[model samples]
Target: MLSWVVTFLIIALIAGVLGFGGIAGASVEIAKAIFFIAVILFLVSAVVGLVRGRSNI
Candidate 1:
């Protein structure tokens, strides 16, 4: 999931460099949304692990 965000970020960078403004903007937005979701999920998982006494984390 984090890989997807990085992929979209790279795509946005390339699209912006190639002058595709609309594509770049859309990709950037997608990247931001995915990044936030990933962060939220990570935090939730961390909390759950702590509460459950999961040491593997």
Candidate 2:
């Protein structure tokens, strides 16, 4: 979910600011992975919509 991606990203930023190196790193990695998955899902949804004869797509 895009919201999850933003949440993890904010967590990473706050942890980094608070000097938590390991937590910051892990959070950033998780955020990156979630963002990628969200993007992939969006693209797949777009393609599927187009194929299904959706005019809005």
TM-score of each: 0.87, 0.87
Instruction: Give the number of the best model, judged by lDDT.
Output: 1
| Lowest lDDT 10-residue stretch of candidate 2 | 48-57
Q: How close is candidate 2 to the true structure, as a TM-score?
A: 0.87
Which 10 consecutive positions of candidate 1 have the poorest summed lDDT?
48-57
Please list the C-alpha lDDT of all candidates, in the order they appear. Answer: 0.94, 0.92
Clash pairs, model 2 backbone: none
Distance from true location, Cα of 50 in model 2, Å? 0.7
lDDT tens readout by residue for model 1, 3-55 = 99999999999999999999999999999999999999999999998898946
| Per-candidate alpha-carbon RMSD to the true structure | 3.0, 2.9
Model 2, range 1-57, lDDT digits (tens) per residue? 989989998999999999998999999999999999989999999999889874654
